[model samples]
Target chain A: MAVSEESQQKRRDERVREIGFVHQVLRRPEFGAAAGCVLVLLFFALFAGDSGLFSARGTVNFLEVSAQLGILAVAVCLLMIGGEFDLSLGSMIAFAGVIIAIPSTVLGWPIWTCVLLAFAAAVIVGYVNGWLVVKTGLPSFIVTLATLFVLRGITLGLTRLITGRTQIPGIKELTEGDWLAPLFAGQFGGSVLVWLADQGLIDKRPDGLPTVQGIPVSILWWLGLTAVATWILLQTRFGNWIFTVGGDANAARNVGVPVAKVKIRLFIMSACAATLFAAIQVLSVGSADTSRGLQKEFEAIIAVVIGGTLLTGGYGSAIGAMFGALIFGVVQMGIFFTGIDTDWFKAFMGAMLLAAVLFNNYVRKKASEAR
Target chain B: MAPLIELRDVSKHFGTVIALNGVSFAVRAGEVHCLLGDNGAGKSTLIKILSGVHAPTTGEIRLQDRPVQFASPRDALDHGIATVYQDLATVPLMSVARNFFAGREPVVGWGPFKRMDWPLIERVTREEMAHMGIDVRDPGQPVGTLSGGERQCLAIARAVYFGAKVLILDEPTSALGVHQAAVVLRLIVQARARGLGVIFITHNVHHAFPVADTITLLNRGRSLGTFAKDEIRRERVVEMMAGGRDLVDLEAELAALRRNGATLQ
Candidate 1:
């Protein structure tokens, strides 16, 4: 009884010296990115609030932009947490767009079939990327970079050879009244917009149409994907596998985790995300261009990094990347609404990235020092 | 009786640097087999072979007298051989419960809705830590915050809990304190009582002697011999180990260095 009592006292002392509540909250990877989101929002609300940046029309514009990037960022965030990079994401977008367009606009196939084909192509590309990296034992960055260039070249060469032009147009007409078109390319909640306009809560154009017809489906996709990703990372056994594979793969393997399969599945997820991005773009824009989705891969990666995912991997959060995407969309459109030269946007991204890294480092150090 | 797991005349040569040469041993159910050796006495190589990290260049591994070969670590684990390594034990960044069930997590629901049973996981982790006499404040706490001894205990407990038959621990108590080492020794006894064939690899005879049913000595990639604890006195096993001469040589060299130094003068 005396020994147990003494040990109990020691445990109590150890608990007191352990991490406090504040330190635990601060140590979470999302804390810095969520804070950054708040600060950016505050800046925009003060500067661009009067310039219609918060208006229904302007809000939809930026949210649509965020939603698109959020989809890819969510996938990239998972891959990064699994300790890999897919540089071919941007090229896959362009290539999948061409794949969707060539069938629907040229061969006159059904829009649904074209969508399926694009998904199929993405699966093959993803599997090969995963296979090469796993089999060759090369860094994923190098293997996917090779894929990036090859996919871009193939997209360009194939489009010009068959269509005699770099662009495929008139896809909008073909998607009209198609049952499957609305899932990837349309607005939701039109009745909600109508009701809001009727209640005088939202603006309506002179023609009696709401300035923003409805919320874009992409935002729905973004939130759904984020929720799902968060669920996978937190609630599922596969989520645990991903963390283990990224944290210490040799240890994970020793404990019987299938390291190769986890990595391959994550790579496949990234490719599918790019394909979804392409489908949304192709159906909405009414055309597929070789230049579509250029540099989107880097943008998604920046959003993920700003979200506080370590480049080295094994630790991060999906919600943080969501806030990271939100911050990005707000700032990009905020500069436009505030009438700053748009060229300065890229410079701001660089500064924000550096600031986020410094802040994350500071918070991590402080959290550790507190204990 | 046939052994639960047995290695017969195993030889492993790595580019002419022979790590193990014609070594043989057997671990039976309900026994604690202590492997005593120096740092480079083929103990690691032998463990590696048994754990399926490396296949023997020439040998036969028989499980219940049935010859078997493991192609990978997973293959070894599938055959109910769980190995807890010295360095790569538990993932520090992971939660204690998650680390406890890294590959084999208990799930609830069906198909896509299947997920980790959070309440059960936490409860099991806390209960298991308590069983091993380690007070875990929270099952959700990252393993990194634990002291070195606690982390070692967590790894050993994980191995003991999940190990179906054979439990191979490589220097499990190397980083432990006196109290923690005692806790691990007691846990080993419990595992053996539950019909586990434990291969406890350590250079410390003091740690090995109390619980070991059989003691095997190795030196320079060769097995000196295996003896029942009755046939081997605690001090005699130390003399037969590779470290006996090496420690004496190290002390003599240190004394000569002291003689050459100005402080000695």
Candidate 2:
């Protein structure tokens, strides 16, 4: 009789005690990433406190690195949320760099034209990557992995064939007065920074210059892209399509969402982001190398995963990826400032990634499990 | 009055295989037309054609006595023919409001300021679920949290709200328990009362009998003819559904086996 009483069925529709506001906040996809970001900052502050890591100059140094990676992260975040991967993103950066450098330096083309050409090439490559995945029904991983090798090979082979050297130089002088170079390579907010330094708000160098000259345009791009990507994810009709497509492509198709189109556009978005990365690097550094952007795709994906995007897709946040990339840049530089073995940086990041994923898993179960 | 939707001697073929053959079916507004079939009975094929996932190899589909062709599922939806598939009704990870308005999201403002009307969406989602007698305390909750019956009701509510003239449900109750099945059957009746023609597909006679105004049996790849609810009784429907007296023969065979076993014992 006791067993029967325990097993008795109740009406399934009883509106259970409502979950509290705090519980609801805990359900956000960005909760883990945001927490991890603050924890990373706290940890570094303790370890590297005396190394000037908190100084404006040093802060901007790490932020510049984060900004560059964040550019790729925004695009990768969207594509991942739409349920595909473009592993060639890293290779495309190197390829786009050469496309920008070779044309402007060797062929005497304008820097702006080379940048445009690089973007155009990226669109075609992205189209191919998406087409193969959509039409052949191959997993995007395998398709884009194949693309990775092809792009890198082309970058190396074409650079060697054309210039007889792996590196391209002499593009810096051409960028000095170039109309488009400042958009990608230069900095802004100099007057504001100088004013701050005059007011003793930030440190000034021995030569009467501010320790940090200005904010990099790359930082602006990163913030702008994150805001736009977040808007797309949260508000637009296409945003809803992306979520449903990733959540269940078959179900999305049944409900009349254009799953293929969403995926293909996402691929193109990531490719253009790669070109943007290359434009910034190749212009600012004043050289191009065949080996640039190696393992960057993995880095971006890791940042996205740390930011709380599902590895399997369908759920994530751009703000989360921003913090994920910030954590990456801070930790990489934090080891240098703290006098830890530089080689331990990768190991530490790997550990951080594992921890982030585990935390995300725990939070996911908490958010979705039965009351 | 002409039926809201009619399949006139429609047949479908996939290369050499015949999936449906000359299956004539009609569903009028204000009725639940139950499609009863056993396994491999071409029920899936017939509904696929009716919902515009596939075109008939022969014959025609008429809406209110006018012929129409649907090139895709979206086309069918545009023409007010909505289908709620058994497993393909919703994306589980998305919020109930998001899933309710998955492909057709309503927006406000203009240009870059245009965005999903979350307040409006949440209100509509809550109101619609309530209309279907489902209690959804939070429209922002992931749809996966809803019980199977509630999810089915959400799908039905979505189709009904989207102006579905003829609703196609593909084996909506086959995976549900008795209680859940009854709930879904109640939704079918509600849809009928709203003057929308409901195509209720199932193999279970018990589930079909209560809501069905017209019973249409499918066997192999053809229809056994349609019958009004008063034209047939429960026992006769069951016998006909069991491949025409095969159940009687099966019962006799079981009895013979029992007698032989007793003798041996």
Q: Give the runs in model 1 whose Cα sits over 4 Å from its true position.
A: A1-27, A359-371, B14-17, B64-66, B175-186, B193-195, B204-211, B229-265
Q: Pick the candidate with the highest lDDT.
A: 2
* TM-score of only chain B in every candidate structure: 0.88, 0.96
Per-candidate TM-score, chain A: 0.94, 0.94
Model 1 CAPRI quality: medium
Which regions of candidate 2 fall more than 4 Å away from where they truly are? A1-19, A366-371, B244-265
Per-residue lDDT, model 1, residue A326, is: 89
Evaluate residue A6 in candidate 1 and report its C-alpha lDDT on the 0 to 100 scale.
94
Candidate 1: C-alpha RMSD to true structure equals: 3.2
**Residue-level lDDT tens digits of model 2 in A1-371:** 87665444222223233444676667788878888888889998988887988788888989998999999999999999888998999999999999999989898999999999999999998888988999999999999999999999999999999999999988889998899999999999999999999999999999988999999999999999999999999989989999899888998998889888999899999999999999999999999999999999999999998998887778888988999999888988888788888899889889878987888777656545533
